[model samples]
Target chain A: MAETTAATKTVKFIISRQDTPESKPYTEEFEIPYRPNMNVISGLMEIQRNPLKADGTKTSPVCWDSNCLEEVCGACSMVINGKPRQACSALVDKLEQPIRLEPMRTFPVVRDLVINRERMFGALKKVKAWIPIDGTYDLGPGPRMAETKRQWAYELSKCMTCGVCLESCPNVNDRNSFIGPAAISQVRLFNAHPTGEMNKEERLEALMTDGGIEGCGNSQNCVRSCPKGIPLTTSIAAMNKDTTKHLFKKWLGM
Target chain B: MKGNSYFARKLHSLLGIIPLGGFIVVHGLANYQAFERGPEGFAKGVGLINGLPLLPLLEVVMIYLPLLFHGIYGLYVAYQSNSNTGRFKYGRNWAFTAQRITGVITFVFVFWHVYQTRLQVYMGKITHEELGSTMHHIASSPVFFALYVIGVLAAVFHFSNGLWAFLISWGITIGPKAQRVSSYICMGVFVIVSALFILSLVAFRGDEFNEVASAAIALLGNIG
Candidate 1:
């Protein structure tokens, strides 16, 4: 059945390809065997198996980053159908013809469909989006968070470091380091955690930096684009309030 | 830069909106006059503005100084920001590009407006059929009109978008409900202001007040 399917019909894809970090990008067309219930990832896998372009030219297999086949990882995000989204969950049948695939330009394309998401991680670092636990010594089960707070913080912790939000954010481009919405949201998440609050001042201090929280242009695009439905702009507003209070506190040396 | 104070940064963003946002409100109101009175009425409206005591001085103090300060500070802030393109922690926030692009366009538009209206009028370079007629002529010209339309639309979107962020930055808004309400108000104000300006231009072109203003200007010239 698989062989018959391979011989019967083809699904076309025009993928943007880059050979190296510095090299100019070009498109390569591929026709893969169509099958029922084929997702974008499965189609890409078929191409990997063939490693042949539509012109019948043998080429290296296309390179892309993916961890979970589910949309949870956000590693396989790219522009599909003129919209930035995750490839893992993008169904092939729902996509229009030409099936245009391009790397998200918000990040430096490390290779075809692979981008350097280091900036996002760096922003996370800058904001200290984690609990600063020093040792492996069994610290008695960490201080408990309020149930209500934990519920919301859990929503924020759903962020998979996916660059989808960043890819869709206009402020995350090469021109400005506005820290974007994802980091701000993460700040809210970590700062709300019981132990994470230990570094609350540091996180607040990070947000008060030049490329920090003040950089948000508040386009609200992040809220719309987030696959996780993370309340980014809300976090930004919360942090805005917290930072203002923090500023006053600093002024009073509280 | 840690602990160096982000107050300047915050102030920079806040002060930057005044020139562009405030100008839109004033310009929109000025445009509304064109709808009813025609080009001549529009001109009269502008003339009335000039008649006010210290009008030029006020423009210099309020408009020019704010424009310069905002533009310069915005540029400095833009330069200081970190350019890290990646999947942001949240999602599609294009605040920086929108602000910068709109700022440039607004800057250019304001300069041209002053050049044609204030400089030319003051220097006796070219007289309008009436102030309204000149406005109509400018708006009727495809190039000037196109630029004006684009500039104004951009200005409106930029202002509304910035207003959302500004409210958030200052802690005026707290939750989803607040944001929704504020967003509607911002968008509503932007639409009303922009419509008023467009209507004024359209009315001026329809010759609503041009004939009267032209006749008046001609009669005054003959009498003098």
Candidate 2:
């Protein structure tokens, strides 16, 4: 194959950058030398290589978060062109020009692209959204889930703590303390486990509290916005059933 | 079929009992009005509503008859839905179950509220002094207020939640994805409505209506 001399095009990015957590955000434009197959992160890297603004002023290299640049870690998730998504896979060729990148507004912006994901972590803790595995060494061959249940649960397990579901969610604003769909889906995931079932009643009871599963309005946005395509609303609906059953069981002294 | 056909009819059918549902709305509205009107205006509002021509007779029919019908029908529907939902494995199914369960709780609360307020009003057992009493009245007594608070909360869950599910049941919310978005929105609404009721109760309990209202005003004023 004859190697063709390829021309590089300039790709523009308008990023909302902040120096510190308390600093006011401002827009910075960059015209990165684009390669044919470059992704958003690669373009960002090009900017990082030469931290000069389009207006010809030297500035600090823009900061962002990224890991498992294959879009699995969800560390690089942001709002690209007004949509919450992973930046690692957001290709320069695919997006509209002057690609707008901002931190997902659902969480507090830690510096620039980094957000305080503590609310999601806190919600996971509140719901006990984990298998109660002890660190006394591996509990060797723990109780297994039914194949059918495992299939659904495997879907739930795909959540990467990416805040996309929460970002698209309307209920997760500062005024309210909704735990968001990811946590709710996690509740379903943990409660379905055999070991997780031991705390099933506890998990259900936790969800019964204010800002628990009852906080879900069934907007169904999380399922839609999920990049890994986790079935979030299904988990919510399943957890709802579990909580109700738990409530009845408690009421009946069963 | 998708836009406001089936569930709207169901809601309309439910709304037809508004004579009783009206009392629920009026009573809740009246109680909430205490936040704005204070004890005197609330009392006047109570008296004015009560003083409407043939209101006593209307109260007997509108209040009790619809109460009896709606209460029994709600129970019946709850029972039927419960049976129909036997051993369903879905979360939405559970949400529906919760809605019915909340409906039962609200029904019980409404029955008790009538016992304390509506029936008491009819029997002339409630003095004018007791009329405009705030959260304590809604909460009623300490023991009763606890139940009332939970019940009002249950009603909040039932109505707001049921309405959301009702949207789904009618197919207004299409697909699993959009349904999820709506569910999230509905959850947000649940938080908001729950907060409003919770704040209202807490304010009533603390006898801080003026303070709460002022805070709300300041908050709104700030927003503006």
Candidate 3:
């Protein structure tokens, strides 16, 4: 009954905008013709085609990042309606007006809706969230993982380095340097790999360092906010246990 | 101080549950004697503890030292935590913030409570028998009694909620469902323990203790 309401013919948007990396952010309102199945990205594209303010004034086109136009890439992440989520999957029909869009400030904001997720990348580097391989030496096929192990490993592998978990976490703010949950889960992912297990101790060691798993305040927000539904809290707990073991092992000189 | 911090954090969490949390539960049970029997029973419980061999050493090792570390390190951790609940309003988000807030409140309340009671005992200001009467004096005051109620509530809450967080960080509760159940269990623990301590506080306000305490107080010449 509400679908065909004349009031629903147009979608309203209040997008937070920053002209440059160092610029003060401001919110601008826009109105776009509503379509039956239009997602937030499609609404932004409509604004891009004809950039105009709701007051009928000419303005620059609102800029945002999106690829795969699906929820998978996570590059399209932004705070929509006060939550860190992918705009590509936030359908206009499902959102309340005026739809509020802001950049996730867990990392530095680049421009409009894009944030520089360099901290997440830096965390991934710190934890060594990768398997080592020498392509030039023509190594044989890597050790096979059991189907059972692979099933769970695939869940963690789905993490697209989205900053949603970090954005949702209060402990991951500027004052504390908590590595956040995404990278922690990635550590679990890489360590579970047969080849990646060779450096399990090293990964666990990295996790024990400053800004590691210990920095987690156990707010448990990361698990709920993850669009990929990666078991972020479980990884954090698993890693917490591993680091405790590694600490004792070092203490006993094992 | 700026090293891995893994051991330091783990040690803080462990110390909180160990000597500190254990001390709270035991203290609650001991105080319950006031409600169970009267001033005589409460005095006897304290006497039993004091009569233990190496009592001072046990107090130092099991209570003071661990509390010092947990309280001090917790303050440092609290200073570093910047909770933005206004932006991200979630249940656990508030709980994360509440844990830090209750920690500070509990520490302050505990410090004042100790300074008022234990430090006085050490300074020969209050004798062993007069301890119950001292509680009677404090709990008889509406202000002190209210503050005591708040202090006990904060202490019990911090301990019980800290238990929940400890289970997660230590990997005992691995999933959402497990964490949810643990929260309920911890709250259940909080309610039971808080009732015991509060009942003790209320019992202390009763005048039955002062007559027995006065006889003992008569022996301590020129005592406050």
TM-score of chain A of each: 0.92, 0.92, 0.95
Output the TM-score of candidate 3: 0.95
Instruction: Point out where model 2 deviates above 4 Å.
Output: A1-8, A135-141, B1-224
Lowest lDDT sum, 10 consecutive residues, model 3 chain B, at B215-224
Candidate 1 Cα misplacement greater than 4 A, ranges: A1-7, A135-142, A251-254, B1-9, B16-61, B72-102, B116-161, B174-176, B195-224
Looking at model 2, residue B108 earns an lDDT score of: 80
**lDDT for each residue of candidate 3 in A1-254, tens digit (9 for 90 to 100):** 67667756889999999999999999999988877899999999999999999998999999899998878888899999988899999989899899999999878999999889888899999999999996778888889999999999999999998799999887777777789899989989999999999999999989887888988998777887899888898889888777777888899999
The prediction achieving the highest TM-score against the true structure is: 3
lDDT of 1 by residue, A147-231 (tens): 9888888899899888877766665666666778889899999888888888899999999887788767665667778889998
B82: Cα error in model 1, Å:
15
Would you list the C-alpha lDDT of every candidate in the order shown?
0.77, 0.69, 0.89
DockQ of 2: 0.04
Task: Please give me the total number of clashing residue pairs in predicted model 1.
Answer: 20
Q: Candidate 2: how large is its RMSD?
A: 17.0
| Candidate 1 CAPRI classification by DockQ | acceptable
Worst 10 residues of 1 chain A by lDDT: A168-177
| lDDT (10s digit) by residue, model 3, range B112-146 | 99988888999988876678998998998999999
Give Cα distance to truth, residue A164, candidate 3, Å. Answer: 0.2
